[model samples]
Target: MTFSPRRPLTAVLLAGALLAGTAGCSTFSDSGRSKYAQGEGKPAEDDDASASASSSAEAELPYDIRPLLHPDKKYYGLAAKGAPASMKSVKEFASSTGKKPNMIEFYSAWGDSYETTLAQNAWDYGALPFIAWEPFKRSLAGIAAGKDDAYIASYARSVKTLNQPVAISFAHEMNGFWYSWGTKKATPKEFVRAFRHVHDVFEKVGATQVIWVWSPNVINPMPKVRLEPYWPGDSYVDWVGVVGYYARTGPSTFPTLYGPTMDQIRAFTKKPFIVAETAAEAGDRKPADIKDLFQGVEKRDDVLGHVWFNFDKEADWRISSGPASARTYREQSRSSRYGFDVTKP
Candidate 1:
């Protein structure tokens, strides 16, 4: 369903009266009822009315998702080394070109002894580091269970030491069929709870440097189901992210994925958005496709930036340089995509 804006309310107050002569401990108090009514409290309600009202409010104003920013007008980020061996080479390429790699989506799972090596490499290269935490893997199962607050707390503390902005995408592509976060086909409410719980730990530890990117795959046709249940409260997200990959498998194009999905995400909240991940496969990464994606973004002030997934992990990446990826990057990097004059700004 397309999202509609919610109504604004004012002057909330408690409705119930206190019992003066109660000798036993009463579960519901006048202040408690009022707190629940105002959404400042979570009380067990026997009647569905109160619960329903609170649930509806949650659906509208869910969690406190953050806003992602780019101080530079045209944000240039590179994906370096899904594995350790490639990091040095990728970093060398970006440094030669004078662009600090904005963020690296490290494919390291939790508790890898080699992570210290990878983290050190990122620190030396001056790269913003991020990793996909795969707790569902057997070795990390306990951490994924949501019962391990201590585990999350410890990880948050460790990441704080890195002193670089880290985006810990626990289970990315949650809206896609691939990940266990949405593996059971959780309901939207369930998804919201799980997603928020992870953030709750980070927030509690005051890890404000961490910019949460709720990344999902672009809406797809059947045989490839889209899992919307994994969408947490807008409050839980810092940036709305979609992974858009172009393929010759069918009628898919960059526009077919990026444009409409951006529209769908923008329909509900005004949070800044990003093309969390992407790769093109079409002939020369057609200018028309690049134009379509930018046209969809230009007018909207809410849309912040796009991160071109810069890797050749897949055989169909269609990657090229201005000379090498010339046909593709040249047309794709036109000024409109950045929405600001890099020269002037």
Candidate 2:
């Protein structure tokens, strides 16, 4: 969930630069979204333990994550910075926005396990955690040929063990050329093979707890590249997560940034779509862009939810990036369309 190509930086420049740099509640991260989840473990609030008891390391999941990936349900939340080492720490962070996130997103490298302390924290808090499982180090061709099976298998086992429901966006934004697994490094055939292979292994391990998401960056980055070729088929994905950003100077409306990608995905899949990552730069139009984003998503029946990349890096992508941006975000998030509720009772 990053913004490397989030804005209107020409796609070519973004790909060349992202060899350079990088959401929402019903909650998002880019540039290794989980890169910031490195906080010291703190004791969960007194009730956090009890609240999450059902989603314990061994207990069966208490809720279904499939709905978040459905073509109709709505979700809203943030890609919070700074990891909370414990469920308590996660809860505290979730509350910082004055509203709990229903969806929590992060990133993972090849070696990280599927069921993490952070995942547990998120599940305990009643938020459905989504992971951008990257295929770094290992190429898509190698993954298609079982090169990362050991790592994939271990992660699959971990998900089965956790038993709680979560979403996994494997090799996200593959159409973009910036990352190793994207257009620059792998062909559409190789990407599909790798995706199915991973999904197959997960199936073998009985990791039904995972909701598969096939996320892509804005098509603007690779306008000439047809996204259809990367499709792993309807069976392989449960949701479509798209990433985009409003530029400080370029087209900063929801329609301009996300419309093209949506129009393309709809032709092929009926799966629900989620704004896996999006942010408006801290500029004159940030507030308006924020309004447009929420308003647009609210009116769309196909969009199930959106994840705001609340951090500030190349651009102040945070909700509080501008004076009224944060307030606008809150009002929009509280709207009826924003189906955020991590602490579901």
Candidate 3:
């Protein structure tokens, strides 16, 4: 979903509850917002038992995910209306495309705790949970100055306790002017500082399970904005997520839409790329655009995969928007190289 100035009441209330809860515990008073509004973990046992259980769970799951970091196959992902929160969107996407997504993308505002249920559910369904962490409530300067350390540390600790591999795209699309952390609102230096600070906090908490994805909107629309200044360096990121769309007026082909951005990014870093957000607009060109998108990722060795923005927000971006588009998506997405059981790498 694109950035909107209007905040959701459900998300606001959820964040408020999280802020009011105890910071030291993994369990939150609320389950956060979800499509079906499911509960999170079971009631906490004694503090010692909870810690022991968390340790055992962490031991059961391997912390070293370097092997899966750069897999041979490209990952297919989806960002639907109610994603990681519930598998309903993913299941519907799978039914339409004939292949379940290897990565499930969702959005979370600042001050919200980690969605443990979402992570666990995605893992159980054989997909990796990808979070677009938006810092809507605070300024990048404030975050970099350690004003939000309490919340950041709390969130990092919760992630560590879960001990699941998660892909986080923090303050995404900073190169754009759409969000609070965007070009008009925050400087590039402040953005980089805040990004590195967040990464360091996660490191301090031993949340090595996270795959830090530094995402920026495709530079096609904003040719004047440079990406290097916003970059948090290679060590601070695991993947470069490029966000773009195939709209009716702008660049339609992959070369014009994402190629330039990828080219610019390559000048600075050789990190693997993921089309973090993309979808063709609903119209006569939708089917062809879908074909181009799948082919574009398939032919590239550096592009690890793509995450289709499956919502109908400004335009009908869903694959099932039309019969032709639906058929084309299912046909083009049938490539054996698209998805895999994330757990098995």
Q: Give the winner by TM-score.
A: 3
Which window of ten consecutive residues has the lowest lDDT sum in model 1?
6-15
List candidate 3 stretches off by more than 4 Å.
1-62
Alpha-carbon error at 289 in model 3, in Å?
0.5
The residue pairs in collision within model 3 are none
Model 2 per-residue lDDT tens digits across residues 250-314: 55667777888889989998887888877776877888888899888888888877887776665
Please count the clashing residue pairs in each candidate, in the order shown.
6, 21, 0
Sorted on TM-score, best first, the list reads 3, 2, 1
- Runs in model 2 with CA error above 4 Å? 1-64, 71-73, 84-97, 340-345
Off by over 4 Å in 1: 1-72, 82-86, 92-100, 111-120, 123-126, 138-145, 183-187, 222-229, 250-254, 282-301, 321-324, 330-345
User: Each candidate's root-mean-square deviation in Å?
Assistant: 16.5, 11.6, 10.4
lDDT per residue (tens digit) for residues 181-270 in model 3: 988999999999999999999888778778999998888767899999998998999999988878777788888888999999999999
Distance (Å) between predicted and true CA of 141, model 2? Answer: 0.4
Ranking by lDDT: 3, 2, 1
- Residue 267 lDDT in model 2? 96
Model 2, C-alpha of 257: deviation from truth (Å)? 1.4
RMSD of 1: 16.5
Residue range with the least summed lDDT across 10 consecutive positions in model 2: 16-25
